[model samples]
Target: MTSLFRPDVEALAGYTPGEQPQESGWVKLNTNENPYPPSPQVVAAIKQALEGRLNVYPDPLGRKFCQAAADVYGVDPDWILPANGSDENLTILVRAFADKNDLIAYPYPSYVLYETLAEIQGTRRARLQLNGDWSWDLQRNRPLIEQAKLLFLPNPNSPSGNSWSLDCIQKLVPPNGVLVHDEAYGDFAANPHRMELLRSEVGSQVVVTKTLSKSYSLAGLRFGFCIAQPDMIRGMRKVKDSYNCDMIALAAAEAALLDQDWMLANRNKILNTRAQLASELSESGFDVVPSDANFVWATHPVLKHQTIYEELKARKVLIRFMQFPGGIEPCDRYPDGKLDGLRITVGTDEEIQSLLKTLRVVIEDSPST
Candidate 1:
């Protein structure tokens, strides 16, 4: 029988999201979701939206959400493009800018979705490897940067939980290509590279994408937006789904934006927890990467990565063990080594304490390095 799918789709592997275990009583910290609940304003606004509008389609352009984002970010509403989520924004970007023959460039071991999107579009990709220290080196990556039509750079990049400096970013700005500064975890970092230079006369080539998932504690809400020049926003809007954002999401996001103080309070707590987790893991003989995101990426000196991951899972404390063969470079691989890298999301203080206690026991039970 002949396959009906595109050849690229047939051969490509889909993105694997973090496991969401159904069973209760498990310490779920594998996914980078905020442990705290969303603001009261969000809940109230959602309830209000439910009471009035279920039959009508939401504003196709998400005017209110764009306005709210504009006010918060100090941009004109025409510069904001709201989406179902940041993931949708990624899709829109791929469709809006790149053709099947164009090259899409992104850092390897960053976001897996960028590669998947390119594959779906049947576009070629230039997977640039990070330096041994997991930082971007512009001189080394100039070839890929020059060839790319669309470039995705994630600040406080995922899996590694480290960031590229603004100076590093400036060197990679393409002379005639689109640069997407994916800032999904920017709020957690102290000095996130916002690419505010794009807002200046030299910024027409860049777009900064953000989400309500992490800092705002609204992962389930599925709301995100991008900031760019009005021309870029208009181009993306033309390629987006007719009614990308629903009424409930719009109301909830607007309310959440209005109550940024509540979100900031929760952000501070998560930052504090992240600091403590990193410190504790470092003291426990793990080579913990200093993270600017809400999670800590660490590798143990002795234990095999899979062994520790299984032990934690069996003990009902779930954390992410990254083992992407050709995607993310394993931090713990030796001549004959087990895949070794852990990305642990920072939870509430009580949950962090529980995780620390369980981790200590797991390490103690294992053989010494």
Candidate 2:
């Protein structure tokens, strides 16, 4: 049979999102979604939006959402570009900046979507491996920086939940390439690398993305935005869909951004729970990576990650077990290129307690080393 898809798309493996099971009574902690519900303002705004605007097309530029983001982030509205989600923003970025056969670079074991996006665009990819401690090494990745036209960096990077310093990231900005700081998990971190500072210094060369999904408890709403120079924002807007974010999402995102206090309160609660969970897991012979995200990346001493994941699932508790080769290697663990680990999302107090109890039982039943 003749294939209609592009050759690159035909050959490329697609991104696998975290599983969303339909069954009730399962302690779902695989995806790093916030356990809390959206802010009251968000709910109200969404309800208000739906009351009369179902028939009208959404504001194509998402001005209200952009202004809300600007007010919160201390940037101008012209610097913001709202999208259906950060994923769509990333796609627009790839399409706007790099062409087929152009070079695109990202740290290995970071967001898998970056690589997948580059593949779909038929762009050359430079997958730079992190050091033994899962830290970026600009000196080692000098060649990749030199060759690439765009770089995607995730702060408090996924799977490992470890972050790189702003100084380190500044050192890695390619001279002739755009640097995209994917700060989806920035709100949970102690010291988020300030995009405003980077933008002031480097102008359009630096682009930072933020998603309402993780922080604002609006994953289902699917809204995200990017901050960059006006020129960059203008270029990306041209590539984006005419109605990227629908009316409900725009209203919800604006309300969520306005209710920053609610988001911060939930963030503090999650951070506290994260600390307790990490401590408990470590005491139970699991090497839990220090996290700045809403999830913990951990590995057990005596069991393969797959075993632990399956065992937990069998008990009606779900967590992520990923085995992307060269994806994550914390503290020289998995030195033999075995990047297998479990990413457990932080849930509510009762939910987390339930997860801990199940985890203890699973660990106790495993065979001794």
TM-score of each: 0.95, 0.96
Best by TM-score: 2
Residue range 204-323, candidate 1, lDDT tens digits: 989999999999998888999899999999889899989989999999999999898998999899999999998998888888888989898888767777777789999999998887
lDDT of 1 at 136: 73
Residues 1-369 of candidate 2: C-alpha lDDT, one tens digit per residue: 888999998897665656888768889998899999989999899889989668889999999888988898888899999998899999999999999867999988777889889999999998888875777777789988988899998998987898888778886777888999999999999998875545656656899999999989988888889999898899999999899889998999999999989999999999999999999889888988899999999987668778878999999999988877655435557646667789999999888899999888888787653
Model 2 spans with C-alpha error above 4 angstroms: 14-17, 327-332
lDDT scores for all predictions?
0.85, 0.87
Off by over 4 Å in 1: 14-17, 327-339, 367-369
Positional deviation of residue 308's Cα in model 1 after best superposition, in angstroms: 0.9
User: Over the full model, what C-alpha lDDT does candidate 2 score relative to the true structure?
Assistant: 0.87
Predicted structure 2, TM vs. truth: 0.96
